[model samples]
Target: MDLESHRFISYFLPDQRPELCHSATIEKFPPGTVIFEENEKPDALYLVLDGKIEFSKRGGLGQYQNVAWAEENDFFGEFGVLDGQPRSARAVTCTSATIAKIPRDRLMDILERSPGKVVLQLFHHIIHYLRLTTEQYVNQMVHKHKMMAVGEMANTIIHDLKSPFTGISLANSMLKDLHQDEETQEWCNLIQAQITQMVVMTEEILEFTRGKATLNQKTFNLGESLEKFQRLNFIYWNQHNINFILRCDNIILNGDENKLMRVWQNLVGNAVEALDEQGGQIVLIAAKLGQDALIKISDSGPGIPEAIQSRLFDPFVTYGKRGGTGLGTAIALSIVEAHGGDITFESQAGKGTTFYIRLPLC
Candidate 1:
């Protein structure tokens, strides 16, 4: 059951030419054509002679979620016939395709014959494929959970090390105060800087549960950032009848401003998509709270689904969004968290949502 060589099924059943003439009919389809849909009764199995076919399943929000694909010479649709069940996935033409459709009766007849080894091989191949798919998914889940566990361990380790780091910093400060010698002061400053950098670096990696990354530590101040966002998104908000508002306290923060900008833009974009044509209001507020910069983006729209709220920042977690990769919030969390910040949200079904962000201020 080599997918690429499934056209060989004809040789075992009948001569390829006669098989097409009597046992099967050759059909052509254009790209994006739906060959079959999930749960549909199987009437015919197909052998792709040319071009490509894709298979997808309906995801949580009724979105098309890709599962597998078939291409030239790949035969499919035998599952339903063999099990006397409906199709479990949707199949569509990915490109203009030439396919040979074998009737259900023809396939069943082959299974009854003595030389049904090819069909048996095909079953073995598909079962093996399904087993591999399940294994991969299980492995992925295991790895995700493992990373989360490791992240917890990292947090504990960092916390334990913090006391010693604090002591070192305090001692260094005392030395700087006691030793007024210029050369000694310079050496103390260098030591203090390196020690502070190490603590900051440790804090930065504590939230990298998914993996690792480098964050730029450049410092800059945002002046009326909320106003700037409102200006840029005014038309978009107006077009959607979404009232936009802005408030700012212009706080300075250290990080790659460009990346932070992208994060803000993505959050706002997510809000727009969450909202309907009935429109709503989006308010962006920025200020300073003690040593941290505080930003809150509130949207008056349908709130995030509770099913995915807890794992909202996990990759591929999405609800209400069509064709969304679900990486927007996850990436936003990563960027903000790596800067020793936190992003949290409060959402209630019909009441809308508010996302709060806290980042260290320079």
Candidate 2:
């Protein structure tokens, strides 16, 4: 039904003066046109006469999340118009559409002249809309609470394992001195390496669960740190026949060296896992981009899977890797962001994935 023939509007139009009724104007908008934005004062009430309109709220990083859709016979922007308040969400045309816009002043004028029946119908629609919104909000809150509970439980369990891992690390260190045979010594070295990895993993989990990463800031050489990490992982990378290359100038940095090293460890480790012993190349390029240190890690692996790309940095999001807790990227992101920097990546299904890390240069 068109706006003039709309039940609520038609009920009141008979009592309104002709000019007041004429104040509702028909507006045409092309696809992707924004009708209104959140926080803007409502000027008019819009009723969708044809095509579709989407309502969204801004999410993290300037993303817009769809809250609802209005199609034929649906009226929007009424809440703000009635309350004389700012819009709670943004409205945009999803497709080429025609909408009827009733100016707020004209709407109030019509309601003042109309009988109690017209106001009752308006109230019915508003109450129904509010009920649905409340239901959605409650569901979100329940889901958030469930996630918090699971996180608290996981943090306790992970915290309890730290002492036992420390004991195992100490024992692994002592075994190196006790075993003198060449073959036995090599095996002990491997065990010690694995224990070291476990120690790093444990630390990452604890830090993530705490939600606040404390940095031990100091001036250090970025290039030297990369070289040392590559050296330490040389044997592991070579075992998979993966060619690892580091091309970086000796850039000095002022940050937490240990935390930054952990970021590198996680990124490099993920790249290696993506390669999966099929012999691919991983390159670490560290260069200066004006006042920022730009570091890019590119891998010629299969690339990140499409399913988890949106929540890639969210904790406990993992793909097909065995024994994966999925906290590596999350921890890496936390550390980098804590240092007043950002991390982003580009990936393609068949080609490869590249991660870019930008940190303020000192």
Top candidate by TM-score: 2
Whose lDDT is greatest here? 2
Q: Over the full model, what C-alpha lDDT does candidate 2 score relative to the true structure?
A: 0.82
> Per-model C-alpha lDDT, please?
0.75, 0.82
Residue 180 lDDT in model 1?
Answer: 96
Clashing pairs in 2: none
Per-residue lDDT for 113-174 in model 2, tens only? 77888788788888998888777667655645655665676677667877886887688768
Full-model lDDT, candidate 1: 0.75
lDDT of 1 by residue, 219-288 (tens): 6766544454455556677888888877778687778765676568768878888896788888888888
TM-score to true structure, per model: 0.44, 0.59
